[model samples]
Target: MMLTNAVLCLLIGYVGSHGRQEMFSVLVCIQTVVFVCCETVLYDAGLYRWQLFIITCVIAAYTFQRLHLSKKLPLRLSCFCMSLYLSKATIVLIEHFVFHPNKVPVYSYVTILFLVFMIIRIFVTEFDTNAHSFTGHLGLLCVSVIVNANPLIYVLSSYIFMTESAASDIAGLCSMVCGVLIIIAQSIHVPEDLRVRYTGVLGIFLGLVFIVFRPNLTPTLYSVFQWIEVFSVISFVIVMVTDSVTQFLQIMLCSAVLGLCPGFRAAIMLYPEDNIPVSGVLLFMLSSCIITCIILCFIKAQHLKHTFEKRFIKMSTMLAVVSMVAVISDISTRENHQMFLTLPSLKLILCANLVISICLKLLALRQIGELLPLTEPKDDKEVPYLPTIGNIATFISFVMICLMAPTSSFYHDVWCCGASLVLVCLQKDMRIFSSLREDNQTTATKITSLVILVTATLYRSDIWNYNSSWMFARGVTEIILVLFSIPNCYILWGLLYDNVLVLNEQIVIFTLPLNFPLILYSSSYTGWALAAAGIVSSIWMMFAKFALQPYHDDY
Candidate 1:
C-alpha cells in the first residue's frame, strides 16, 4: 500500500510538472483517485494508519514550501485546510452520537444527515472556482460526455463483452487506413476549386468503405447504454454540422447522464463488499469526473481566447503525438522484452528536440527583426558575425552524427557525414558550389532537400526493424532525429542567406511519409488512435496551408 501511494504521488508530480491549466485539472482528478483508494484501504483495515497521515503531511508541507518560494500560492489552500478540519470534527461528532453503545441520541439518522450536509457545504465553498455560471458548467460537462462517449464505448465493451477478437483489430486497422488516405488526398496538388471537392469525395468514399466492411465495429451495449451512446454520437455530429451551441447543449444534456454510468458501474464492481453505500461511492466518482471535465472546458476556453503562435502550436502538436507514441511503445513492450533505449535516452531526445526547435524559432524571429525596414541602423564595427553561428551549428551537427554513429547503419553514418561536409563547404563559400549558391535557393527548397536527405538516412539505417524490443526504440530515436533535422535546416538556411524561411506546406508534405512507418509499427489500439490523430492533424494542416496560400503569395 505504501509503495502504491508513493507511485501514485510520483505520477501526479510528473504529469503536473508542465503546470499548464489543463494539466492542473488532470492532477486534481488523479489526486482524488489516490485519496479514494487510500480511504478504501483504510476502511477495510479498520484502523487509521499514522504513516499514511505522515506522508500526506509531508507532501503538503513540501507543496506549501514550493508555493512560498514561488510566491503564487492561492488563498484557497488555507480554506481547503480549514474545511478539512471542520469535516473531521463533524465526522467525529456524528460517530459519537450514532456509533456509541450507551448513548440514546434523539434523531440520530437526521443528525448524521445534517452533518454530511455541513461537510458538503464546507467543501463546495472552499474548492469551487466559480469561473463559470451554473449553466455554463452544465453545458461544458455535457460536451465532455459527448466527446468522450465513443472511446468510453470501447472501454466498456472490452471489459463487459470481452471482445478482443480479430474483427475489432481489423476495424481499428481499417479506420487507420482510411484516415491515412484522407490525409494523402488532402495533400495532393490540384486546382484550388476542385481540390476541396476531390478530398471531400475521397474522404466520404473511404469512410463508407470502412463502415461497410466493419459493420459490427460499434459495440453492442445494454439497451440504456446503447441508446445513450447513439444519442451522444448523433448530437455530436449535429454540433459539428451546424456549429450551434444551443442545439449542442440541449441534445447533449439528454445523453450527459450516460457519463456517470461507467463510474457508477466501476465503483459497484470494486467496492461491493465495502461498508459504504452504493450511492455515496457513485456520487464520489461522478463528482471527480465532472470536476475534471469542467477544468478541461476551462482550459479550452482559455486557449480559444488567447490563441498561441502558429509555430508553437505546431511544435506542441508534434510533441503531443511523439509523447503518445512513446507511451504506446512502452506499454506494448512491457511484457515482451527489454526496450532498446533507456528512459534517459528518450528524455535526452525529447529535450534535444525541444531545445533545437526553440532555438530555430528565436533565430528566425531575430532575422525578421533585423530585416524590418524600421529597424535602427547598426554600427559597422558591431555587425553580428552570422558565419560564426553557422560554423558552430555545423560543428554541433558533426558531434551529433558521431554520437549516433554507434547505433546507425554504415550508410546512415556515411550520408550524415556527407551532409555535414556539404554544410561545412556552404559555410566556407566553396568555389565548386559558387554557381549553385549564386542562384539563391528559396528556404522551402533548402528545407525540402534536407528533409529528404535525413529521411533517406533513416530508411537506410533500418531503424524500423521490429525484430527485437530495443529495435523499436532505435526506430523512434531515428524518427526523432529526422524531426530534429527539420528545424536545424530552417536555422541553417537563415544563417546562410541572412533571410528567414517561413515554414510552409513543403515541410508537412515531406514529413507526412513518416506517419506510415509509425502506422506499420503500431500493434495496439492506443497506438492506432495516436496514428489516426496524426493523420487528422496532417489533413487539417493541408487545408490550412491551402487556405493561407494567397496571403503568402501576395506577401
Candidate 2:
C-alpha cells in the first residue's frame, strides 16, 4: 500500500510538473524503486537500478501521455536513442572496469532516454531561449558527442595494441590520423555559427556506422567518416562556448569537477591518454591550453574579461583534468587499489595555485569599488563579485586538498606562481588599488568574515578525519546538520531569485523545470552542523541587510 501510494503521488507530480526534469527524474526513480520493491515478481538484475529507472519513467509516461509509447514502435525513435546511450554505457563500463583508471560508473539507462528527448526537442520544440541558453544547449550537444565517442577514442588512443599488433598493421597510424582529421573537418564550419547541433542524432548515427566499418574502413574511408562526426560534436561545443548560457554552466561544472574532484573515475575521456601516444596528446592539449589562455589574456587586456574568465577556467580545467588523471594513474599503476596513495606535494601545488589565483581574482575585484563612478550607475546583479563568506568556506576546501594529497612538481608549482602573477597583472587596471577609507573599511569587514569562517573550517576539519568513520555512521550531528542546511539553501535561493535574474533566465529558457530543482538542490553543502550554520548565517545576513538599508542612502 505504501509503495502504491508513493508511485501514484510520484506519477501525478511528474506529469503535472513535466517541465522539471530533475524532479521528474527523481520521482521516476523513486516510483520505480517502490514498484520493484513491492512487486511479487522476483527481483532480477534486469529490474536493477539502471533498468528500473527507465522502466519506471516509461510507466509514468504511459500513465500520463500514453501516446509516448503507443505512437513509437518497438524499434522506435526513443528505443534507438536508448540504444545509442547503452552503446556508450557499454564502452564506459568496459573502459572503467578494464583500466580501473578512475571511478566506478553506476549508469542508468535513463541518461540515454534523456539524450533521446534532447535530440527531439532541439529541433522540434518551439521553446524560447536567451542567446546564452541556445548556445549552452549546443555546447551540451558537443559534450554528448565526446561522451559518445568512447569507442573511437579507445581505438585512436589504443596505440599500444595498434602499433605492436599485426592486426593494426594494415590500418597504420597515418591512416588513423587522416581519419581523425577528416572527422574534424566534417564536424566544423569556418564561421562558428554555421554549425548545427540539431543533427546531433545524425552525427551519432554516422559515427556508429563509421565505428562499425572504420577497422577495415576501406572503400569509403569509414574511419574518416567517424572522425567527421566527432569533429561536428567538437565544433558544436566550440560554438556553444562562444555564445551559450548553459555553456557557461557546463564550463563551471567541468571546472568544479577538475578543481575539486580527486580522481579520474568521474572525468570525461576527451582523448583517452592510454590508446593515444602520451607525447602527442599531451603536446596537443598543452598547445590548446596555451592558445586558450592567450586568447583570454587579450580579452583581459581590453577589460572585457567577464565572459572570457569562464572560458579560461573551462580550458584550464579540462587540461587540469588530464593532469589529475595522470596523478591518479601514478598512484595505482601497480594495483587497481592505488587510489589509496595520497600525494601531498602535487596536491599542495594544485591547491596553492588555485588558492592564489582565486585570491588574485578577488583582490582585483576589490578595486571595483574604488574605480566605479556612482554617476555611471550599476545594476545590483552586475556589481562585480567581492568574495563572500561562502567563498571563504570554499577556500577551506583548497586547504583540505593540500593536506590530503602530497605532490609538488616544479612545473606544477610554477603554475601557481604564474597564475598569481597573471591575476595581478592580467589587467593594467586590476593592478590599481585605491587608499580610500571606505575601501579599507570594506576590506576589513571581508577579512574579518574570512578569518572567522576559516577558523570554523579548521575546527570542523580537525575532528572530521579523526572521527571520520563515526561521522559516516550517521547520528545527531549529521541529522542536525542536514536540517540546518536546508534553510541556508532557502537563503541561497532567495538571493538567486533576487539577484541572478540573468542566470535564472538562462536556466529557465533551456533547462525547463529542472531549473527549479537545480536552485533547490544548490544547497549541496548541507549537513547537520552545516545546515544550522546556513540558517543562522542567512538570518543574520537578512538582519544585517535590514539594518544597513538606511545606509544605502549615504553611499
- Give per-model TM-scores: 0.21, 0.21
Candidate 2 matches the true fold with a TM-score of 0.21
User: Each candidate: what lDDT?
Assistant: 0.41, 0.38
Candidate 2 residues 1-555, lDDT tens each? 455857666674656456444454444445444554443132222333444445544554344333234432222333343334334344344444444422323342334334444444353333335457665655554444344333333444464444422322323332333333334433442124434333443444444434333444345655454444444334434534454323344444433322221222112233234533344334333433333342333223224334544444445455555555555544444234434434322442344345434543554455465542212334855533322311332344344443443334323322322322222212222113322223232332322232333233333332345456554443334333333333344334433334222222222223223223322322222122232334454555555432333323544
On the 0 to 100 scale, the lDDT of residue 243 in model 1 is 28
lDDT of 1: 0.41
Supply the TM-score for candidate 1.
0.21
Pairs that collide, model 1: 340-470
Top lDDT prediction, candidate number? 1
* Total clashing pairs in model 2: 33
**Model 2 ranges with Cα > 4 A deviation:** 1-299, 303-307, 316-379, 382-397, 400-555
